[model samples]
Target: MSCPHVTAIAAYVKSFHPDWSPAAIKSSIMTTAMPMNNSNQVLKDFAYGAGHVDPLKAINPGLILDLSEDDYVNLLCDIGYETPTVRKISGDNSTCPSLSARSLLKDINYPSIIYQIQLMQPFVANFTRTVTNVGFANSTYKASVMKGSNININVVPQVLSFRSLGEKQSISVNIARGKFSEPTVISSPLIWTDGEHSMRIPIIIDVTQT
Candidate 1:
């Protein structure tokens, strides 16, 4: 015989609600999820031939944004970002990983620091702006690199690998009547092996530290 049905259980299930929000829930699971943490003791662990967690590694994970570029520029420098007149400080560990600028503006704009580099070589082939949140909504301040020159650049990493998270796809600019060319932003940790050189766009993450 089948067991008796529990009305209360059914009622509870019907009343149950979803936690947090859909956007937040989606954010928790994405291609760019931030690192999570455990106990504080995790950080104090010693490092040698060892598997030990550290104090810093044990703290709660915060939000983060990664910046990259093909050409050198101040695209990530001195840029400012805030919430509708309410300037919230960046995280406590704001850092500039590359030699380029140590910071990015909350708002992405034109003539980016990266674009400035194209100036060094007016004879560019094709200029592509793969990242650099330029022309995006202010709510999502982004950084971008601008390029202009006359030269051919059929190099490594192709035109497709800058960043997938940024809105408004990358664009290519032709100066010498469509000859010179290069991508605007390049994903960091990129390997430029074929007569190619990678320029690390400097950036300062976690502004709170500043």
Candidate 2:
């Protein structure tokens, strides 16, 4: 069901922006989706990944978290893929970074944030993401979070200013777990609005006993 719907939406977006990459199309659909259901309840990431896709809104997602072939190669490297495997998959002489320089998985410039932490421990997960401007040539966006209890989420440089089309900006999301007694899962959103456009991404935190 969702497969066909998302496929059609992807095609629709592609028809409009023929130069956009698959990652950009996916980002548009995810960021422009409705996070809440018909009953006005926020959807969980596990149940509804990125909520219901809004085809119209997706056509103009304001900002897109576009990724390149190199980004995917880096992601595989960050996930501990061996150099030979990565080269085979990428069909290039790409090499993995040193262990000390490898990036965290959550740092991938996707349209969502999901992190896990050990129960009863203090931890901070920092994610770095870059978004390309596709809306108004001159626009400013402000970041806000609909955070859950027992967690603190902060966005560095809460405001992003874009001077022209295709401009890109990088921001950091720092998530720290607060003191809590029981293991639980929390779902929230990090939203960026530029007066006309509202781009959102889910932030899920799982506090596990293991």
Candidate 3:
């Protein structure tokens, strides 16, 4: 059942652009999904990962956070993988860097952000994302944040301009703790809109004692 569904979407995308990776196809499907059910009720937590697939919107998601094999290798290295093990998995001559040099798991080029923050510490988490424009050229998108909790969220380069199709731009999200007294998970969405299209990314911040 799911295989045919995925294949249809993949085929539609491939018909237009044959260069998209499996990861990109998956991201597009997830990020553009509808978060509501037939009754117009919002989906539950982690339901379908990013809710039910929206195949039409997935086709033209405006912007995509593409990933490569190196990104997966970095994800493994971030979780304390040794050089030899990482290199073995990658089947390459790559070397894992020191802990300080390793990329943070939250920094992965994913469609959504998931992070944990210490409840009592003065903490700030930064996530840098690159988006490839798939929408109209000469478009400008503005950033907006929707909150379900008390974290302070800011997006640098608040406005993005695309000169041509497939143009890539970098955006950074800076999240700082503020009045997060209760130990709970706070979820929000960082949205970028260009009047016609919107790129929405869900952000879940886990507040706990570290």
Highest lDDT, which number?
A: 2
lDDT of 2 by residue, 77-176 (tens): 8777899999999998988878777666777789888887887688888899999999999999999998434578989889999999999999999888
lDDT of 3 by residue, 10-67 (tens): 7887666678887777777766766544233233334445666767888888888898
Decreasing lDDT order of the candidates: 2, 3, 1
Model 2 bad stretches (over 4 Å): 38-43
> What is candidate 1's lDDT per residue for 1-210, written digit by digit as tens?
111222332233233313322222222122122223223432211111112212221121111112334111233224332222222233233333453533234223221112223322344334343332211133222223223322222322233332323344443433222312442322111111112212222211110111
Winning model by TM-score: 2
Q: Which ten residues in a row have the lowest lDDT in candidate 3?
A: 37-46
Better of 1 and 3 by TM-score: 3
- Per-model TM-score, in order, reads 0.19, 0.92, 0.82
Cα distance off (Å), candidate 3, residue 77:
1.7
In order, the Cα lDDT scores of the candidates are 0.26, 0.86, 0.78
What value of lDDT does candidate 3 attain over all alpha carbons? 0.78
Give the lDDT of residue 61 in candidate 2. 88
Number of colliding residue pairs in each model: 37, 0, 0
Candidate 1 vs. true structure, TM-score: 0.19
lDDT of 2: 0.86
